[model samples]
Target: MDSATHQSLLNAARQVFEAKGFTRTTIADITREAGIGRATFYVYFASKEEVFAAPAHQVRDQLVAAQ
Candidate 1:
């Protein structure tokens, strides 16, 4: 996928995972929030767990950069 599409998926995944928690959120939920299709979500992430982890990793990177 293109960078815009990937970022959109990541942003949507982050929102859904944050709101509902990883275990409770579904691919459909992320896709709906992202205004994309469920298959599109799958193209970007393997699962909800990965979605949750992605933001956490991003936060960690930001913190490290700030330090």
Candidate 2:
């Protein structure tokens, strides 16, 4: 996996989701925010939902570790 690209996408997705909210955000919005092609997004994530889950999972893992 291209970690740099993946992190870029994650950061972009978070920004977009925050700005537009989940229902209003689209894969195109995320890719646009990431300054990458839509196809590149699919190469890293199957769907917007999957990408959205990445940060959530990270937070969950951190909470668990802190417990």
Candidate 3:
């Protein structure tokens, strides 16, 4: 997928994961919020757990950099 699409998925995943938490948020939730398909979500991330990690790590990196 392209960078724009990937970032959209990541942003949508972050929203859903934050609201619903990792275990409760499904592929459907991410894709629906992203306005993409299930296959599209899988193209970028292997699973919900993987999706959760990226944003959390990004936040951590930003926080550390600010310190």
lDDT of 1 at 18: 77
lDDT per prediction? Answer: 0.84, 0.95, 0.90
Residues 1-67, model 3: lDDT tens digits = 4598899999999999889988899999999999999997888999888888888999999999999
Q: Per-residue lDDT of 1-67 in model 2, one digit per residue for the tens?
A: 6599999999999999999999999999999999999999999999989999999999899999999
lDDT for 15 (candidate 3): 92
Worst 10 residues of 1 by lDDT: 1-10
lDDT per residue for candidate 1 within 1-67, as digits (tens), equals: 4588788888988888779888888889888988999887778888777777878998999999999
Best by lDDT: 2
Candidate of highest TM-score: 2
Report lDDT (Cα) of residue 47, candidate 1: 78
lDDT of 2: 0.95
Each prediction's RMSD to truth: 1.6, 1.1, 1.4
| TM-score ranking of the models | 2, 3, 1
